[model samples]
Target: MPAIKDSRIIILATNGFEQSELEVPLNELRKAGARVDVVSLKEGEITGWDKNDWGTAVKVDHTIADARVTAYDALVLPGGQINPDLLRVEDDAVAFIREFHASGKPVAAICHAPWLLIEAGLMRGRRATSYHSIHTDMENAGAIWEDKPCVRDGNMITSRKPDDLGAFVKAIIDAVEENASARVAAE
Candidate 1:
């Protein structure tokens, strides 16, 4: 992997996203010189789910209808029970995830965000990890489920929870910096 100063990453989420899951990777990826956009269903702001209640509102940089998959080097999905649940049902969101992954771009999902991957049909026969509660979901999606902090299979990455954000963020940076062909060969 080379320097990622010019890498553009999309952090796709919506209302009820887990606070740390979105913020940690967004801030860290930016600090590492990657351009990250908080793309959502709408253009205003989306509130996060801290733990039990609502957290801070994160500005939406672009709407799903407007964001082009070709414009980004990677996609990051932040998880919370409600976040992925809401996103997986949106046809546009699922199409974006599928097309992004099919293009061989990096796609990282943490916690329950793998639900979106499941919706995208990107989990079959892949090695992955997610929130313990979603182990069955992953298995049902044909993913080789594990309990690790971070699991990287080809250009896709998955982690257990906010506690695994460090590894998850690092994985995305690595994936972005790595050669696209190399990632496909890694599959």
Candidate 2:
């Protein structure tokens, strides 16, 4: 596996993110030695949604208005019913995701986070997976939905739900290391 020690990752989210969805990758990626930032819609912090209610608050490292896509190697979008739904409507959030995906960097969208991908116009002809609840929404947006734990197509890494996070994170690290290797080769 990749250590990802030199990677700079950004987790873009707002309030109501899935608790484990954000926390797991953040902790695991950091343990792999990556510098991870939790970028939200504002400063201070953002709260996550747990099983039945609001969960822990993750500190905000930066806001979407202040972040630049070129500064990071990958982007993680954690999902909950509310997080992506709210973010997808924000013009800045959608635009940033679009630009980042266009840059060909790894963009991981777990569960409902795929909604952001749809809003960014990135799902056309892409193979992906997401929380079962959004199957129709995903298909309508032009994605080829697969019923798997994780689906990696091109630069997009997506997962079905929390139980599939292990595979999701692995795919992300693999993509990051692969992209890094490609860049080094080109140089």
Candidate 3:
């Protein structure tokens, strides 16, 4: 397993984000020694959507408008039916994701989350997987869609749905750890 040590991780989401989808992977990242920051569409706090009810609130460290792509090593986009769908329509969120990808930083998205990738136009020529319903959208975006637990292509990783959280979190951790190790070796 990869220990992040001092690596910095950024999670981007908004209200209605899938509760466990964000929290589980985030907690695991922190446990492995990564410094994780939660960002949102606005400042203050954001609520998560549990299975059929409201979930815990996560603090917002920065608003999408003020986010800088170069400040973090990795990015995570959590999904709920409404969260990423709303985010995909936000210009700042789309630009932030685009910049992050252009910077060659690891970006992980799960469930309906890859909708944002489609909006950012970063799915072209990449392999990804998401909730089954978005398979056509992903295919239309030029991504080679898969029906696997997780699919990783270069700095991008995608998983099918909330149930795939285990594989989702593991993929993010592995990406972060791999980057951390590479950075350490270069120093």
Candidate 4:
């Protein structure tokens, strides 16, 4: 069977998300046969940040107001300096992330995306990694921050930056497949 076949993955992002952080994982997950959706803070579309400038826009599959954590099997948070910074301050976004984490589903965050986990109060005691610039913020929030390319702690997975996309995406697929297998075994 394909890894994560029939699994539904939701990518939570907003304007100014890191381009590759979102696109690469989304593409990889879909290639692994998972149904991936881009859920944003607003409807219509969200633009990405390509290093120094705004990048291409991705169509929104669902808005925060309509996204329900139970509808999907996993969550993805793509980091850009502005994206997670904006999401961390949004009550609905933070609530959604908190609820998702509580569900015990897989959550893969890359680059600055871990900021949302910190804001949602889910970082404490978990081993994770993110963009080097935010190491202190992550540590102060009670997370065991590492400088590795990718780190997985239970249902949460994280990566340092774009260069870690391969490892990051693989972790996500592995987590999803493991979760699926667990569910089947339980049944």
Q: Give the winner by lDDT: 2 or 4.
A: 2
Whose TM-score is higher: candidate 2's or candidate 3's? 2
Best model per lDDT: 2
Mark the regions of model 1 whose C-alpha exceeds 4 Å error after superposition.
180-187
For each candidate in turn, the TM-score is 0.95, 0.98, 0.94, 0.98
In candidate 4, which residue pairs get closer than 3 Å at backbone N, Cα or C atoms, i.e. clash? none
Candidate 3 lDDT score at position 17: 96
Query: Residue 10's C-alpha lDDT in candidate 3?
Result: 91
Worst 10 residues of 3 by lDDT: 1-10
Model 4 residue runs over 4 Å out of place are: none
> What is the C-alpha local distance difference test score of candidate 2?
0.95
The residue pairs that clash in candidate 1, if any, are none
TM-score of 2: 0.98
RMSD of each: 2.8, 1.2, 1.6, 1.0
lDDT tens readout by residue for model 2, 4-98: 89999999999999999999999999998899999998899999999999999999999999999999999999999999999999999999999
Model 3's number of clashes is 0
Query: What C-alpha lDDT do the candidate models reach, one value each?
Result: 0.93, 0.95, 0.90, 0.93
Inter-residue clash pairs, candidate 3: none
Model 1 has an lDDT value of 0.93
Question: Per-residue lDDT for 4-25 in model 3, tens only?
Answer: 7667889999999999889987
Scored by lDDT, model 4 comes in at 0.93
